[model samples]
Target: MNNLLQINSTDVTVFVFAGIIVLALLFGFIMYFLFSYRHKQKDFQLLHDQKQQIDVQKIELEKTLRELKSTQAQLIQQEKMANLGELTAGVAHEIQNPLNFVNNFSEVSNELIEELKTERQKTESERSAGTENDIINDIEQNLQKINYHGKRAESIVKGMLQHSRANAGVKEPTDINKLADEYLRLSFHGLRAKDKSFNADFKTDFDESIGKINVIPQDIGRVLLNLFNNAFYTVNEKRKSASDSYLPTVLVQTKKLNSAIEIIVRDNGDGIPKKIIEKIFQPFFTTKPTGQGTGLGLSLSYDIIKAHSGEIKVESKEGEGTTFIIQLPIL
Candidate 1:
């Protein structure tokens, strides 16, 4: 009986240990599954957040693309307007000649008519009275007025025809100084047409030794015109509120440096800001308010000079003035 009891007791202890181990293993498995599920949930949340971020970025990119397209369309429209302005200016220049002829001829014709009427009245009176002196004096006076007016009308027509033709096809070795002078006059005339009291003090310093340059006369003339226009615009703005003693001025000068010729256009108007100085040569960069500037004049001028193997540079100080220096190869 004792031996049987001892064996039963040992068996019960082994059974108890086995139950404890099985319960511990079950708890461990449950804990592992809970941790694994939590880890999966965290990973899923991270992926969901990543997708949301990607969606937001896509939306921003689409918005940016739309903005770019809109800006490009506006630039295209501005370019078209600029081209139209150039065409209009050219046409206006052509029409001025004929208009000038019409004006001059009309004045002369009116004066001649008046003189003829006076002579007819005098002749009628003299013939009725049989007075020889009155007839002779009337004939002399009428002839003088007719001759004067006829010559005046002819002169006007000739001038008008001459102005109508292109005056700059001939590319001869022209003195740079003289070409500059002519452009200066034309530029001033253009400004005066727009504003009668817009005169600014103009000065020039030409290097006599620079001599002639090989360039298309019209092209150079146009370049000078652009420069003069900018200068006048700047000076005019400053002189709007300036005292008579503070009259604005522009200085144009030329110098020969080694194998290159340098021309400078300087103005005492409000200078360009530093942040934009580098961007001034870029197409469509303008300091002037909208509708006041086309912004292509300088860019086109820059391209023309570059095609001639030249360079343009600027030096400016805010509130003082700005200077544009153009350097061209002497050869």
Candidate 2:
């Protein structure tokens, strides 16, 4: 009985020891599992925060880009208005001459009518048939003069309206020669009206065979006006310091190529300096005195030409003269 009791005690102790070891291993595994789960959760939360930050930055960048585009549009419009302002005075002056002619001819024709009625009222013995015929001829001539002047005024008004209106961005067949000539005269008159002493002799040599070309008239006209105005400006400036023998002249020439049409605006004045010539087409670049220029004319012209699938380049010498050549595709 004593031996049996001793064996039973030994078996109970061994079983207790085995149970303790199993419990300790299970507790250590549970702790490791909790720590690994918490570490994974922290990494996932950091990634989510970074994703949210990137989204916010993207939204802010888009908003900034939109604002920048709006600002650029406003500046471009302002430049167009500034150019139109220069053309206005010239349009007014150009219109006035035709108006005066129309008014004078109308008045003369009225007088002729009164004289005709008077002649008709006269007795056959008092009125000579030859005198009646002469009066009628004079009246016919006056009417013709009135008609011609009326048409002239109409054309000038059309041009003013065309220049003032916003570009519709539509391409149409346009008489390039006429367009160039018109702007050249308009620019010349504009300068003259501003400064009574400003004078420049301008000439045109156009290739009549080029015919009408497909282009955005308003945009091309704006380009020509800018160049003509600049040419006149340079010549006028040179005139101020030039000797008595100096003659300020501007010449516009056009030609036809196999696949393109070329327009040349040449001036005899203080040519652009070679150092700054390459920068002329860049935005906000100008040699004009402050407040006298916006520095956007050439930049805009460059853009316009490029939009039309054309090229514009300049050749200049410091003291001799400058020439701008533009070549537009046949399309």
Candidate 3:
């Protein structure tokens, strides 16, 4: 009976120890789960914060883009206004010559009319022999001068109209020779108007076989004018340091090939240095002094030619001269 009692007590002690061990294990598992859940929550918060930051950056980038676009628009508008102002000044300067001729001729014609009227009022006996014929000849000369001035004014107005019209990249059949020749003379006259003593030997070799090629007339005209203007400006600059015997000359030539048309504007003046020949077409790169060059002229010309599927190149020697060659496909 004592043995049986001892066994029962031992079994009860074992049961109590086993229950304590199970409780300890359960507590450890609950603590581990709690810590793991907290860690996951912290990670979630960090991820949410990063996403917010990215969203804010995206909004800021969009705002920056909007601002950039607005600024670009403003810059383009300013450029247009500047171009308009330049065109206005050029037209006004060019028209002065014809207007002066008209004014002077009008005054002379009026005087001649008065003189003829006076001679007519006088009796035939009082008037000297051939006086009437002399008065008639003078009046005819004045009328011719007035007519010539009127035609010149008309031509200037027509040219200005064509230049002002915004016919962007519209190609049409154009007489390349005529276009080249016209701009050559126009540029020379423009320089002469700016400086009374400016004179250059202008020459043209137009290929009759070139016929007509499809092109943007106004754009090409502007290109020619820019090139001719540059050529004239170069020669004139050279003339300043050159002797009186130095005759500034500009030559324009056109050639028709089986597949392409080539136009060349060459000058005998101070040439472009080799280093700068590459940068002449870059925007805002100019060899001229401030207020003398915008530097955008050649850049714009390059862009225009590129748009037309053509190529423009320059050849120069340091002390000789520069030649600009333009080649356009026959398509």
- Which segments of model 2 are wrong by more than 4 Å? 1-54, 128-134
Residue range 30-70, candidate 2, lDDT tens digits = 88888998898898889888888988988998999899778
Q: For residues 40-141, what per-residue lDDT tens digits would candidate 3 score against the true structure?
A: 989998999999999999999999999987975454344334444444545566577778988998898788788888988898789865877887788888
Better of 1 and 2 by TM-score: 2
Q: What is the C-alpha RMSD of each candidate to the true structure, in Å?
A: 13.5, 4.6, 7.8
lDDT of 2 at 145: 87
TM-scores of the candidates in the order shown: 0.52, 0.83, 0.64
User: For candidate 1, what is the TM-score?
Assistant: 0.52
> For this target, which candidate reaches the highest lDDT against the unseen true structure?
2
lDDT of 1: 0.70
Cα misplacement distance, residue 101 of candidate 1 (Å): 14
